[model samples]
Target: MPTPDLMTAELTLTGRITTASNATFLGSIGEVEVVYKPIAGESPLWDFPHGTLARREVAAYMVSQVCGWDIVPRTWLRDGPFGEGMVQLWQEQDPVQTAVNLIATNQVPEKGWKQVLEGQDEDGQMVALVHEDSPALRRMAVFDMVVNNADRKGNHILAMTDGHRHGVDHGLTFHSDHKLRTVLWGWLGDPLTAEERDGIDRVTEGLNGGLGRNLADLLSVEEIESIATRCARLRLEGRFPAPSGEMPAVPWPLF
Candidate 1:
């Protein structure tokens, strides 16, 4: 049998995800489940222009594809029950697996994980911020840097049953300024692997081709140029960078 056209299929709203700051829905396109965030429901942000978050979400997916990282899930813009929105294929994450976590400072694992920072929790107990030391997460960090991802919370990193990691909620991306705030800072100042370097090279090459043309529709010329510049800088540095800016390097309520 032929596959159904998800973009044009009738979308049925099964439920709403009330926990989201923006309006988000759990819906189905034919038999396929998806998470829908309509542009019309996007709240106004002081830093980002209105009615553009959905486009940014799609743009992040495009860059992920260009980099061959598969970090973001399959996402596209389409009309939904509310209005035009960003619809992404829902991924079933492994219930017992998480890419990052908060653990007591003394309980931090000595290997296979990277400690990002140490701080006190609500009860004033010492806690540590850490993430899995894996290539999948490193790729996500690289992707975030290129996109200027402003809010990469710990929970945004989904660990799938297949062991692949996926990053989601990319509405706060592509700002021309250096607004990268994320939880995956474990690789700070570490050298990039050859595969990671190659991925960056692929993104840079794509910018001069179809990827650049596609992004032109979703991002400003300055934003696109900034992405190219970031790739170049990362390549030249050949290492994961330490966060540097007036803003906090990590997002609040990290999870």
Candidate 2:
């Protein structure tokens, strides 16, 4: 059988993902399986506008592509069983590999990992948040900053079997305000590498052209401007930024 054109093929809902906060579904289009989050099913949020989450997801994908990082999977907005929504190619993450981990404070590794923070676990035992130190995750961290990702939960980072890292669930991104909540604070205060700076430059340049035009349809002018400003700021600072603002630095439940 021929492969389906994901962009235009009819999407059939196979099952509902009950664990999701919003109405999410497992869908198939020809030979491909996808995760679909319909706009009509989005739970209203005080900070974000109603029904715009799907667009934000797609916009994040576009920014990821422009940066040439491929951090976000193939995502787009299309009509589904409920209505127009965000659809993304499903990735099978390596079940055994977790990019971020919570280890006992005394058991934290001495190498190849960055300790993000230390806290007490539910049992009041000392624990530390640590993540692998690698270029893939660094690129993802930069992507999150550029998008102003407000919810970068640990589970959102998909560790692929082939060693690639993919970031998903980007609906809470591109807010005009500074809302950079995430569990990937391992690189906080570190200097940006040359490659990372180049990626930021690429995004900064693209925003004035095709990227800017495309985002205008999905985000308000202020939000688009904010993204460009973030790129510029990151490039100038050349370092990972520490968390600010009254909001928590990490997403609740972390995972």
Candidate 3:
């Protein structure tokens, strides 16, 4: 998306992203519903250690675009009512009452927690949280690991009404080293499926050609190498790579 000027005359604040660690405003950049990061928000969180979250978000968007996966928010660098930072078009999700809800709810059954992205019920009715993990979802997990996504909580997985899973929030990615933290742990020791392996191969081959060139513009050579290394390790090991550092395997406050 083309970036708008800092002094845009038509932007309007419609909502606030209170879920994020820092303050963010939801506004329209032209006709898109975008979450804007203004300078007026609170200072960065000391524990997270992102000097500029907006920059990382934009970089992650670029990576997603090159990877041929529309898992990221439609991001762009622009100035909004808040200030200059990354802006993303908001995604809409279904509001069904389900078995595994990301957000807290009291009405859901205790045995099977109602999730935000439920699947069909026993009676063929649409339920909350979908059942059965998908190849696309697994692919997204590998991509998240490659990008060093620091935040991959359940709520971040936007389950669209059409059965598509969209991952969001890339502000904490590409830390120049192994810093992956996520919740998609379905395929811990399982072998990569054909499609999953094919995707990895595609990325590996792409890195040798146009993909590397494109990533180099936004990420360091070492960062890109780490991505390749991780991909190779997963392919060779036929399992999810284990963490070497002392950091927590999952991000804090999983929900």
Candidate 4:
């Protein structure tokens, strides 16, 4: 569908996503299904220390576009039935496909996956947090760093039928701090592939052009400048960074 239609079209609320931390709705603009999150319904947890969560979600989408990774689904701010909010094209993920999983430690596949952390479950069974070792997820990890995503929970990654991964719930992003909480730390200290470095280079160049201007509407000057700084540092380091000791490395509820 066209952009104007999504923006001005009448939004009908079909259902509510009760599992979301903030007020999230499953709705549609005519025949096109979409997710609408009105700013008024946002939880206070995300409003603090930064801009509105709705705008931050859009900011993440813009950065994802720069990476050309399709990490985030198409998202934008639009007027809805309740009020102004963020509207994103809803994706029907493959029910059987799972990019991230928590498996018994001893059962973890030695190949085709990487183990991130291990601990005991409530029942005292040892388990490990693991993710598929694939190019698509690698690109997602790189994209997460650029956006400073603070809440990359397992459910945020949508495993698609074509093996593509779409990341959602970016309300806790671009905080202008070292808050990179996520479950994608399996590649810590690994060398950045040539393709990953090239993606960062494209973002750096974009910062000086349209990308920078576009972010200004959703993020503060400090937050926008931080993106450039992050890109430069990643380019210089040429490796996936380990978490800073000052903050939590991974989000709670691994999957």
lDDT measured at residue 193 in model 4 versus the true structure, 0 to 100: 98
Against the true structure, candidate 3 has what lDDT? 0.66
- lDDT by residue for model 3 (31-144), tens: 667677753564666444544567667767766666666778677666665567667778887777211243323344544221333345446665443222565577678778
RMSD of each: 0.9, 1.0, 6.8, 1.7
Model 4: per-residue Cα lDDT over 208-239, one tens digit each: 99999999999899999999999999999999
Where does candidate 4 stray beyond 4 Å? 1-4
Model 3 lowest lDDT segment of ten: 97-106
Question: Model 1 RMSD to the real structure?
Answer: 0.9
Instruction: Report backbone clashes per prediction.
Output: 0, 0, 18, 0
Point to the candidate with the largest lDDT: 1
Q: Which candidate is the best by TM-score?
A: 1
Of 2 and 3, which scores higher on TM-score? Answer: 2
Scored by CA lDDT, what does every candidate get? Answer: 0.93, 0.93, 0.66, 0.90
Judged by lDDT relative to the true structure, which candidate is superior, 1 or 4?
1
For candidate 1, lDDT tens digit of each residue in 1-255? 465698898999999989788999999887788999999899999999999999999999999999998999999999989999999999999999989999999999999999999999999999999999988899999999889999999989999988899999999999988999999898888999999999999999999999999999999999999999999999999999989989999998788
- Model 2 lDDT tens row, 121-183: 999999998999989999999999999999998889999988899999999999989999998
Candidate 4 to truth, TM:
0.96
In angstroms, the error of model 4 at 27 is 0.4
Looking at model 4, residue 45 earns an lDDT score of 69
Local lDDT at 45 for model 3? 62
